[model samples]
Target: MKSSILASAAILAASLEPVAALSEPLQNILINTDRSPIYRYPTDVTRGIIPIPVHSHNDYWRDVPFYTALSAGCISIEADVFLFNDTLYVGHEESALTKERTLQSLYIEPLMSVLKKTNPKSPFVSGPTRHGVFDASSGQTLYLWIDVKNNGEKAWPHIIKALQPLRDANYLTKVQNNETFVPGPVTVIGTGGTPLSQVVSAADRDYFYDGPLKDLTGFTSLVSPIASTSLMEVVGDIKSDSENPLNPTQLEAIRKQIKAAKDKSIGVRYWETPGWPIRLRNELWRMLWKEGVALLNADDVNAAKEYF
Candidate 1:
């Protein structure tokens, strides 16, 4: 098995050799069921990280959150945040929140550790080399899509404060004088009612806005690095026949939205796509992939990684 969990079913299936004699490292992904928080394989160093364009939707819900998607080469990950009592708790809703599971614990702290590993302090380099999350492509900016599940106007300041760890380390991408976007280890994007007014108003801000893909006419890359829209909103319920791959109207709608986002030099991501009728879902994935969408929004990182 691949060092990453379900990293490559294709590789596992194509090896053709007998499975009984597979090496320990080869068997790690296939048989390793050690789910204890402390259970980390020795092979992680060699396995390392690869950056893929796929976005890990609801990333905190995964078995290991950010690490799981990173293991599978997903460069983008999201968290639904609800701020309360001066702490940003991560959960799908308030009911699911736990004091133990905070934005800092689940994301910020872990990412700081990952960045620490990648961007090692050394005499070899003159200063801090802003290496990104994945070791494979250390210079590639990892997108941290923060969805404001609560009141953005109230929670945003706390959210910015929560980013101090990254900011202090100089790991966050920042804008200089509202014109130049200096890419760094992580690019923080605000989505899901995350106050565009606040984002645009900041003349010197590390975070950016997530614009609507359907209408990005007024926006620019300086503010929104990525323009996003709901897939269901863009193309109606996906019903693909094997013979007829796409309804012309739906296909046209997709092209228009993609073009709209691309015109502003921003990447496009379609969230809330179809899930059931697995065939239709796969078809949509393929469609998005083929159309050259910047990042494919996904819940199944393993399948998405394999698809690419």
Candidate 2:
């Protein structure tokens, strides 16, 4: 009887047709909850979703793909892309791939929708102003980190082609005359096996390369807006029991890596941060944030929000 009631409620919500496409969980929530207090339109709910500095790692695996991260106020999100039969499938593993969850459908469409609502055609504004992802603060650009799981050179063209809607709408951050960078609603950074030569050689490209955090003396902000390295690799090992975790050597290495990235006018991020031994994990997170890391890459964004 309860299942029938929820089913009937879901059908009713679907029939009404909310302004934005409802994710599976959201539809279920609407089905179960009282409709009186719910927002009339789905887009109305996004107005309250503020953008945060945290990055959502493995974002596609979540219940609602993009909406899950956005609802958590994550300004940065990652998508692991695999090329299969000339189509980009968004998934963590090969077995998880699906026909319906293409990069275009899961990321591009939803992004375009949100951006359209955020940056509406208005007469009040002047020539042009860059709009960010959040309704609360529209100046901060959302970083779309694309981790190419296969041949990046072969996959580059497809990714560029997929960004057509954003490109057409002038939503991508662009480098002016190979010198000045203008941050827009979305800044796509290609990482993990993405070729540096291809990224650097593109004289007129919207996408930027993720520079190596350990080797950042060569590149500047124009080509690489962000630099990243493995936390474990950098610091050697992290101990949960110790209060004074990082020794002199480890501290120096971290400072140098961070300084190198900062000196180039670029942002820095570290992956695979310690997760267990809760106290030490929090301490490590604090150390990174305090040292001026641009985006704190976190698999668990809720914990990150609280860490901040």
Candidate 3:
């Protein structure tokens, strides 16, 4: 009897060992004194914050909101690329292009510096490291959404060639000419006049595609669509007028679109919504969240962060 009792106790103890090992106390325990909260959020999770890239119009240096948004953990940022004379500048429109604030000066240089201090081998870094710089690890990547404001035909090759160095070094992602190239750790989202069938085919070869459901349906109707092996990112570019924050019909349309995309188990994003007004943000967030929209694009990161 004593032997049997001891044997049962040992088995019970063994069973509990795994659970005990897995359990961690939910209390504060400092690992390092000078830790940054950059990686506080998990990358796999969908609460990614994306800031609109600063342009020459905004005093990029004095843009406190933009920097604050980035420092506070915006996972993605956009920059409009235009070749002026021989240099690439970040500006929303061609009219705003200038020589002083080139893309490298405004964004690339600063980004490269930050990356060097964080991830020295980051394809963005150029020269030797500065002494006594913080050896920080690169946290979640920033999606350098290069919005090509130029004609698709004229800009494709030039942009591709210019990005070669970054592409080769595995820092740039190209989203043009209907080919989604995911070379290295960088993900390029192509956005040219490529047929959906061609985009879908390339996606099968391990590329990401962004499209609207309406457009995709039209593509499928033409051909026996292959099982979409690549990830699908949906966008709802909702329009707003002064009469209503967003027209009732427009809101309903967005809802239907979101539903259709979610039904197919694809990630969704909405753009061109109103600015960071509380009522508008809340309404959009509630509606989009209900339809299972995965990401929210905001003009102001702070407003979006509050809603999320």
Record all residue pairs in model 2 with backbone atoms less than 3 Å apart, i.e. clashing. none
| Whole-model alpha-carbon lDDT for candidate 2 | 0.84
TM-score of every model versus the real structure: 0.84, 0.83, 0.53
Candidate 2 matches the true fold with a TM-score of 0.83
For model 1, which pairs clash? 1-26
lDDT of 2 at 54: 85
What Cα-based lDDT does every candidate model obtain? 0.85, 0.84, 0.45
lDDT of 3 at 289: 62
Query: How many clashes (backbone N, Cα, C below 3 Å) per candidate?
Result: 1, 0, 3
The list of candidate 1 runs beyond 4 A from truth reads 1-48, 240-245
Please, what are the lDDT tens digits per residue for candidate 3 over residues 25-81? Answer: 422233432264664532222233333222111223235422454654554455566
lDDT of 2 by residue, 60-123 (tens): 9888888878878888999999888889999988899999999999999999988877776668
Tens-place lDDT per residue, model 1, 1-308, is 35565757656776876657778786885565576446754224414566778999999899899888888888899999998987899999989999999999999999888888777777778997888877667788889999999988999999999999999999999999999989998999999869988898989999998888888878999999898888887776666556344688988898988887787788889899766566776888888878879998888899888777
Model 3 misplaced regions, further than 4 Å: 1-69, 121-139, 172-186, 190-210, 218-252, 262-265
Q: Root-mean-square deviation of each candidate, in angstroms?
A: 10.0, 11.3, 14.4
Q: What does candidate 2 score in Cα RMSD to the true structure?
A: 11.3
Ranking by lDDT: 1, 2, 3
Error of 3 at 26 (Å): 30
